[model samples]
Target: MEFFKTDKIFDFMGKRLPFLGLSSILVIASIIILFTKGLNFGIDFAGGTIVQVKYEQVAPISQIRETLKSTKYANSSITKFGSDEEVVIRITGSSSDLTNDISDEMHKILDSTGKFEIRRVDMVGPKVGGELREKGLMALGLSLIVMLAYVSYRFEWRFAVASILGLAHDVTIALGAIALFNVEVNLDILAAILTLLGYSINDTIIVFDRIRENIQTSKEDELKELINQSVSKTLSRTTLTSLTTLFVVLTLYFFGGEIINGFSFTLLVGIIVGTYSSIFIAATLLVQLKFSIGDFRAKEAEKLKSKREKEKLRAMYEQGTV
Candidate 1:
């Protein structure tokens, strides 16, 4: 299905100034919000108790929430799991007495309802949550470093730098959106963010690879034109991939319920941002860095010459022509 051939639109390459300006404002505002208000870390990041309860009959989540609200527990979150019959309750309470009493009270309340059963109860300490947070940060940093090294090794340092910046742009934008919406940052969300980073980079790498190919093959054009051609050639793939993924994510967002909502939301934003970065931000960064095909061709020719020389040397040694 050809979705409105974009050939006509491509004639007038749209100005990126507006996008850059708006994205910059969003990123800056998100950073300010992050520093000022900070993320509302969920039980996984901050210490909390999680209770997974199964009910014989479908019970009202609002009733459960109301029951928990009447208690002295702070920052309680009650959500339905796969169905109304299943519920996951999270509470953040540091006081030993409060934690102990709250659990007991919850059991008593549910027991009175006679429709729910306590299937599992788990408690996470603040220390553990802190460690997880640290580990998560470390993982994100390591992934970025690895991506930078890989891109640099495969292509050029300029590409690596630009790709990483694009990744940062996507991440910052996602985080900013989350902050703007005051969404709770939980382990699921962190995982989503990390997944977004990887997925976004994958999209970027595809574009970068195309650019590299175009640079090698399309020798008549300057860097900007080469990049534009690469982007234009890859536009269909990028759009189709993003749209297909968006369909799945939209499905999850609408039907996956509260459990997967954070993950889905993160993915939705990531896909859009990833597509945008691949087209504009990533290629634009390369252009801004003044990357030239001359340098790339020189490097490539050097590599090709070295390979050919090695091949000739081997052939000469075999045929005694050296």
Candidate 2:
């Protein structure tokens, strides 16, 4: 069934101003949030302790949190583990020794409250957290470099640069949103952001691939017209892919529980932003990079001239228009 006809509503020329303005506002707001409020880094990034305990029966997280609050480990987070019978506690104390003591005290508290088993106890040092932060940034940088190389080699340098720019745009916007909302940035959130990078790029590559194909086949069309056609042709596929993925993401976001909430929210935002970037940011980037309209126009003019010459010769030979 046809959902909607391909109207030129998103024509780059017509809607460029609005799109650019909105994107600029989003990006700037995100930057301000990042610098001012900053992200609430989780125990995985900040030095803290994680304790996993298994209960003989299911226990309420609120009860666990209250129990820890009553003890010396006042600032603690208690959440369910994989199953109802298991609970995970995270505590961020002032000192490493205090953190460890807090973990031990938590175990004793849970044991006293009910019959439970301590499954795992782990502590992350501030130094270690710093190292993890460095590594995460390095991984992000490497991914961008690799994407730049792959896209540049596959298409053109301009396309490669544009694709990377689009990816950056999505990542920054996602990070900014997270910061603005004061969401915890843990290993999982980092993982989600990285996943978003790859996902957003996939959409971009698809659009770029179509653009490249249009460039090759439609030699007579102007660059702007070719871009419009290319994006329009791929509109259905893009919409279907995004909508199908969003259906699953929305389900997870609504019902995935606290553990996966951040991950799902990140994915949801990424998908929406990714789709938008693929069309406006990435394609508009080509024009911004000075893609040389002259090159495309010259090629089209040559083709037109060749066609006219052939037609004129045919007319002379056939005694037609002269």
Model 2 C-alpha lDDT per residue in residues 56-149, reported as the tens digit of each score: 8886677777777777667777777657888877778535556445545666676656878787877777778888888999999999999999
Give each model's whole-structure lDDT. Answer: 0.80, 0.80
Model 2 lDDT, full chain set? 0.80
Indicate the worst ten consecutive residues by lDDT in candidate 1.
4-13
Which ranges in model 2 have alpha carbons more than 4 Å from their true place?
1-10, 51-72, 75-89, 93-104, 107-122, 293-322
TM-score of each: 0.85, 0.77
Evaluated against the true structure, the overall lDDT of model 1 is: 0.80
> Which candidate number maximizes TM-score?
1
